[model samples]
Target: MHKKDNNIDIANDRNENIPTERISTMFSFGMGDFIYEVFNGIFGAFFFLYWETEVKLDIWIVTLAYVIFAIWNSANDPLIGYLTDRPNRFWKKYGKRFPMVMIGTVPAILTLAAIFSPPFLDPVQGAWIYFAWILITTCSYELFFTLSSLNHYALYPEKFKTDRQRRRAGGIRMALALVGTAIGFIVPPLLIEYENRASYTNMVWIFVIFNLIFFLSLIPGHRESNYLKKRYMKEKEEQKEQISFWDSIRIVLRHKNFLVVILIFFLDSIIGVSLTASVQYVAKYVLEAEAETSIYILAGFILGALISLGPWLFFSEKINDNRRMLIIGVFLNTIFLLPFMFANDLFWLVIAAVLLGIGGGALRIGRNPVMADAIDEATLNSKRHLEGAFMGVYTFFNRFALIAQGIIFAVVHELTGFNANLPNQTELAKFGIRLHTALIPMILTLIGLIIFFRVYDLFPEKTAKIKQKLKELKL
Candidate 1:
């Protein structure tokens, strides 16, 4: 027997209740965030600087290389998602997402190491070589990164079915992410000096080791049950809907609510990268401080984010409105950015970091749940569990942040006449760093918040109905 509504199919052959996952399972899943943030935070914070300043590549060459990397990185994600979402031998044996995640893990870390291990060559003479190395290594890193992260993200909606569960898991993930980000930000400066290229390589090795050790936690989280596997296979057999790659992409693009989430996320990615990437410049030129000062500044931000997590989660749970929570987050973030832009001294800068952290914590708290809400609605509409494709497309847009940041930095530096070789940059250069870090991000975030407020109509009531529909459809 089957039920049909609005030309949609609902299976009656099998119905499985959503499992109540153990705290340990949640922790293991959350560990993936830690690993992801640790790598991402470091990369965002230092990768461009390493090439532009330390390697002495021409800014234009570095920018061009990143543009190429961005193109490959952003374009591959949706394809990866579509490819992996299909039924396969691995899906039947080891589980649907686990093998794919494992395949991507080691290679991703290796390539991340290779990014800092560029061949010793003259920056101007071997500019193309340097550009090629960056383009290849970074794109390679993102290839495996997309593979692992897309599956990890896909699992969230599948594994945690309830709003309460999503909130709990999301909170844990954000908390761990901040800790990983702290490690990424704090440890690099402790190990690296501006003049020493070898120190950067050493820092990469340390992160590589740390990430491998922590990746074990992901194993337990990725475990799939016989029931889940059977259900997945059964659905694949029953639906028999042949969704092509372009069709999948088309469906994802046409989802209005999903597009809103994707756009907001895209803007947020730029904000995050711009702020993180500028910290070293801020510490170096703006504050006229040693490399270690970067640690203190990052610490202030991390500590602020850490301390505010509890309150943000608490209030978000009370509100039970992911949309409202995200709105509040954006508003808070916009307000907090001004202090950092104006602060000249270490004390004031750290104070600003704290305020930014509070706002950041709020944003993190709401981001995933709202995203999950969007995913739930999409699944309900598509009548298929296409979380992988959805997440892939989301990441597809998200990776363009790299390209956007590349353009922003190139334009700003060129216009400001910022010279990386100088020990002390001009006042214009310092202002350029400030513009990317605070002012521009603030403006983009404000625009995103406004658009999100206007277009995102998946309010609590609507989301609840979507969930109910999904339940009825057994997706």
Candidate 2:
């Protein structure tokens, strides 16, 4: 039997005619990308570099800190997800997700600055202090970021009800995200000279302010529609079984499509961290370029991503299959990245960056829509509104990328005998940098592609059924 309430004919009540104003307002939410990507870019690209090189901490110490941070992230993200997914009395007044977003903004800003500004101490004392600080600051940052970001992510499937709408909004969102990523990559190195702590701290201040401004800009766009709220409340009233937190995790893990998506995300996270973390090293060590020269290489990649978004969107639509498009994108990205393993000249590296960016665009554009499809499918099967929970788990596993990154850095540095204090690295160190930049990521991408082909089954027909079920449920 269909769960029905009040004979309100909720399907008829839906605002099918999404207003132009609403679309514009909703799309403006992409501004949140500035906050998301800037922090992500800074952390991924420079955090290790700053700590190990500038602060003069042992690389192994830095690696251990991140491992602990990853554990904290894994624990907190799902807890936050579970908490947010539950029906809240207070959320009724302000909206479920917005309050979390609001509460998190200030703390996020403060912690971001704190991560960059460690107090003065001797290297041994500072290492311990930095370890403690990293743990505290990272947990604080992830808590707020997960609260805000998971909600922001949940809003996508709710707001953009149709695939077409998702595609359009997602394109704009990815474009803005890449732009922020570009700025995050290109601007930081320009700010921090080699071993210059003061300049690095100054860059942190600048980024913190930028994060505050962009995060606040999301306030207006976070308003939940009355229709969605009423629907959720009615569903809550009609819910028969209340699943426990562990059950939710179990269910998410058992979800075949979600597993596929998570694995893809997991692998992609490695690729992302590898590139962001290694680009500066590649420029400085392998190419023997100036510190600021990495900016151009990163810019080439991001600019290519920005330029290629539209075409990727067009091609995905033309192909009418996101999964296929994603496979092609990943394959091509790997292909393009292969050249980077050997490219020592600035010109060739820039060329490879552009091609990789084009492939990156394809990968970026398809991820959200595909994930939304998975969430929709899971919701239909489970009869639960678990976007928060799902995204939480999604992010939880995604944090493994950082752990993997730490391991990569520790192992590669140890193997290659990379010493930050050295005036010049050995050829082995350069080779390790190249491996992180290209070879490892390419290998991971291939593994991801193999898994994707073997497991991911969210083709057009499956998505159509999911959408049809949602329609019947008046969701």
Candidate 3:
């Protein structure tokens, strides 16, 4: 899978325009995102049980309630993407992302507080409260999430001028993001053990407290990119002023290459969402590893985060190629998954986790830069202001992947009767959980290649043309 050269060298000869310090600060956005993911992913995994199992709502009501909250969250993703990019949006203004992010925090926290605050009534009354709180949190969370994420990603082109720079920056961001994600996933299960050995409310508080703290870090350090910098100047009178909002969006949707990214990324994301949602089930059932599985994922996340640094330091510096490296990583992920299908013991499962770590590490480092390269390529063709629209569309495509994943989970949960608080499920139910976790993710990794192969040679020269024009416009 590893090759000597990539399909494109979008910045092979460009001087390193992004300093290490700026990259470090720029990557701080990951800290915010990582916090969000940890809370969002973990809460999604366990909150239903917090309602039906611990809070003890009726199964029929809780099931439908969870579905209602889920659809509410999923439906808002595209809108979040679309609106976060609106240049004229003027409520609270640091820039496009920060305003949306700032505004979103209040609703998100309120919703979360409502979620954890137990309502006192019979099942019917409780269901309505649950629906209202969860749905609101879901909506606010989606807004907070997409806005922060799009703003974070938008910083890339503004701060970094070359492909290598983008990759290295991405590596740092993922490494930190993984650290936050690992802490989010690993700590709660181990640290917040129940006094009664079953009470989950304590754990929910633990999750919520950290989530709040995660956002606080951003308040002090989070600054928006300057849209009117000399470094960011545009040469063409048409390109100098940001393209009109509608025009900007039209450019993104019209690009065919961008479409391929959307297709493959969504497929890959469906697998991601399914595996993440099923992590608890797989750990408890298929691997039969219990708490060890969470530990296993944490270990994998840490290793993956660390491993990403090596490529930025070594291969990204030495080789002008990433396509082959990405392919190598994808297959590494594929190979790692193979072990899970055959793994009969925890020892072998650990090995599979490590391999996944390595594979995921490489993918994390390069993934965003590839998109950035694609965006650069699309801009050359469209010649309109497109970063926001691209970010918006990218958000839409990825969130839909999460939505697809939720569907997978819903189907698999029903299929397997994944009884959240039930003492034990049937052997057949456990097998279905295994299939959800293993086979589906493996399939998606293989399918990712199809989208990648369609890359139509986005070399550095192409980006240089855009950069040169941007420079001339500035002068």
Number of the top candidate by lDDT? Answer: 1
TM-score winner, 2 or 3: 2
Q: Write the per-residue lDDT of candidate 2 for residues 1-475, one digit (tens) a residue.
A: 2222222122322444232224555556676665678778888888888888778888888889889888888888888888887776565556677677778766877787778888877878667887888788877887877777878887778767778878887887887888788878888888888767778889989887777777767777666655566656776677656668998888788788888888888888888898888987887677766679999889889978988988889998898887787788778777788988888789888988998899899988888888898899898988777888898899899999889888988899899999888858999999898888888878987888898889989899889988888777766
Error of 3 at 151 (Å): 1.7
Stretches off by above 4 angstroms in model 3 are 1-24, 47-78, 81-84, 88-93, 105-129, 191-199, 207-209, 219-221, 225-247, 287-293, 311-313, 417-421, 459-475
User: Which window of ten consecutive residues has the lowest lDDT sum in model 2?
Assistant: 1-10
Computed on alpha carbons, the lDDT of every model, listed in order, comes to 0.86, 0.80, 0.58
Instruction: State the TM-score for model 3.
Output: 0.80
Q: If both were scored by TM-score, which would come out higher, candidate 1 or candidate 3?
A: 1
The predicted structure with the larger lDDT, 1 or 2, is 1
Q: Across residues 214-303, which tens digit of lDDT does each residue of candidate 3 receive? A: 677665335543332322332222243555556666778777666766665666565555656566666655655455456676566467
Which regions of candidate 1 fall more than 4 Å away from where they truly are?
A: 1-16
Error of 3 at 53 (Å): 5.6
User: What is the per-residue lDDT of model 1 for residues 321-431, given as tens digits with 9 covering 90 to 100?
Assistant: 999998888778677888877899899999999988898899899999999999888888877788889998998899888899999999999999999899899999899
